[model samples]
Target chain A: MRVSAPVRATVQRLTLPFLIFMSALLAVLGKADVLLFDRVRVVLADVLAPVLQVAGEPIASVSRAVGTVENVITVYHQNQELKLENQRLLQWQEVARRLQSENEELRNLVKFAPQGAVSSVAAQVIADSGGAFLHNILVNVGSREGVARGQPAMTGDGLVGRVIEVGGRTARILLLTDINSHIPVAIEGTHDHAMLNGDNSDEPRLVYVQPKTPVKSGDRIVTSGSGGMFPPDLPVGVVASVGGVIRVETYADLARLEMVRIVNYGLDGILPDGWVPTPQAGRRSHARAASSP
Target chain B: MPYSRNRDYVGFVARMVPGTTTFLFTLLSLLPFPVPSFGSIAPSFALMAVFHWTVYRPDLLPPGAVFVAGLLLDLLNGTPYVGLSALALLLVRTAVLNQRRIFSHRPFSVLWLGFFGATAGAFALEWAFVSLMQVEFLAPRPFVFQTLITAACFPIGSYVLALAHRAMPALSA
Candidate 1:
């Protein structure tokens, strides 16, 4: 059926405004916590997710290949470096062993010891939203894998970031390098607390530190877990100076992130009251204690 | 006589091919890929698709369709408001439509220059509107890079669309 010229013109004129109106309505409804729209978004995401998975496969494969090559090169250099560092570490290890025995004896004598717990799960980084404005990664693990929002994500080296959004099969992690990402951290040497804030830059700035706090470059920073949003004592980063601004050089190298450990260091609310274990549990406890301390 | 019927058939095929191809290309642009060093950013694949269609087949790629495609992108990327992208796309479509006479037969360099101009205008408008809404800055750098990459890929996209146009014998003028 051929449409009249006037009718065709009318259809063309109405189309743009109609779409504009519908889009605005959808946005408003979404903001209003319309359960229906949220569910729709989720459903659409589910439908499109497989396409994303397929498109991402080639990129992931390339990254893995590159990572393997880089790892081999680094390992060769590290092996030689570790040979020398190992000798010096042996002396430190002896001193540490003596100090550990002395401290244990003192704790046993005093009949007082604090114990904490730790548990973790391995996850693959599937997607990275690479930019200073919003540093986030999509992990394969999701709520189905017991990955809850606000759970602390880490790399082998130290704290990576926290999970902010979770789907049934995927979760979005807000990395420590994002401009809006901030965490309460404490300097290892001076025991001073400061807020690590990302400013769309590689190194996140340490803010709110007292002027008298003896925070120096190279000092280790760990999550203080003041608000309980994250587990305490997770190694966050080391203090670095860039443009005279103190920033945390995070332990997880954002440039080469591959696999990550999503810590299930179960929330304190889930723990049994005043119950503690020996040795193994004690070690876990010590790790937790050291995390905050 | 029979030539009128043939022309109608050709127009029908031309319209069908461009719409379907643009839709699929737009979908491809939204796929999430992990960046080794940086986090995730959805590049504007739909923008490139729309731009190509507008430049070569404006009759098939209309402003209304461009607006809808932008809305889909905003939805998939989780942007605050959908109309912002739609508005930007409409502006790009209108600009291209107005200058189609000059650009329709231009060399590749001129076409690319036109693309850069259109993309920059769209990006600036998008950034301004998004910033005004107080939503978190999604970083324009990635989008800028994506536009450049899309511009680079235009020849390929154009060629593919052209092949499709040619394959459908009914679409050939």
Candidate 2:
């Protein structure tokens, strides 16, 4: 059947306005994380993640090649830097040895019971968050590999993010540079606790510190583990700039995140004994737990 | 345009090629390759596709596919608001769909310029939506860079899309 001109034009006019309304509703629902939409998103991600994994294969090797090229270009300067770093490391090694023995003896005398062994699953970065609004990465490991919500994901350098959504074969990590990311952290020298809040910029600000807190540039920051989301004393980063506005340079380079480890330090308070009857409830509880100071 | 009853299977598949190719290109952009700071500023290939197909062949790359493409991107990249990209694309589609006459007849440079303006508008909408959703003003530098880079990459997307569009008739039947 042939369509009439006026009717077709009316429908065409209605299309844009209708789509605009639906798009707004979707944005609201998605940001609010309405149950139905989030479930579909998670399921879709799980289904589509393998395509990402396959697409990511070339990325790893290409990055590795680029790394080798850079290494070769800077080998001489790197050697000189390493020579000086080696001497400093040697001095620190002796101090660490003494501290370790003393701590072990003190622990033995006090009969300290060490917790269970920390286990971690290694995963490849399959995809990067392409937009400016969110800084996230998709890893190949997921709930099937025992990864769960609120688990701290790290690289060899330091913390990369925390697992927010986990499917059977994939998980989404919320990077510390994301606007929504707020991590509880402590300055090394001052030992003052603060929050590492991401503002969608490279350097996340350190907030919630007392005015008298003696924080300085180059002072290290580590996970405070106050909220039970992460274990105590995980090295996060060093204070890149401290005066005026405190900023931390994360150890893990968000730009070149290749491999990640979802650490299972048995610190996940949301899912007690790996019991998640429903994913939405588990995620909600984790959010509630995360909000408490 | 609605899928007419007279349209053949081959015609339907041919119509879908542009959207599918754009979806794949968008997927390609998500890989974290070791480029110097390019990962954060990688161009929006999907936007380029939407803009291109909107100007040339809205019947093939319709609003519904554009919306789905945006949502697919959201799910893939794990954005906070899933429909922000969709809204941006829909707005871009609307913006271009009305002015397709001038764009369709303009020279290549003018087309590129048009893409730049549309991308700027779309990204502004996305950035505003995100800041409103989070209740804070997000830094504009990233989106600004993304818009520039995407416009610069427009020629490449257009070139490839032209090839796909040109090559479809041969494969359709």
lDDT of 2 by residue, A87-118 (tens): 99999999999999999999999999998889
For residues B1-173, write the lDDT of model 1, one tens digit per residue: 79999898777876788777877776665444444443433445566677777877787777667776766655444343445666767777778877888777778788878887887787776656544443456457755764566567667766777787676665556
The alpha-carbon lDDT assigned to residue B24 of candidate 2 equals 88
Highest TM-score scorer? 2
- A1-293, model 1: which lDDT tens digit per residue? 89999999999888756766665555444444434433443355456666667766787788779879988889978898999999999999999999999999999999985756666778776555532234666666777788776678888888887776557776666777765466677777666767776655667788777677667778899887665667668898887874467877888886666678888766642123222111233234334443553
Task: Name the candidate that leads on lDDT.
Answer: 2
Q: How well is each residue in B113-156 modelled by candidate 2, as lDDT tens digits? A: 89999999988988887777666788999999989888998899
TM-score of 1: 0.73
lDDT of 2 at B48: 84
- Candidate 2 chain B — worst ten consecutive residues by lDDT sum? B1-10
Local distance difference test, candidate 1: 0.66
Worst 10 residues of 2 chain A by lDDT: A273-282
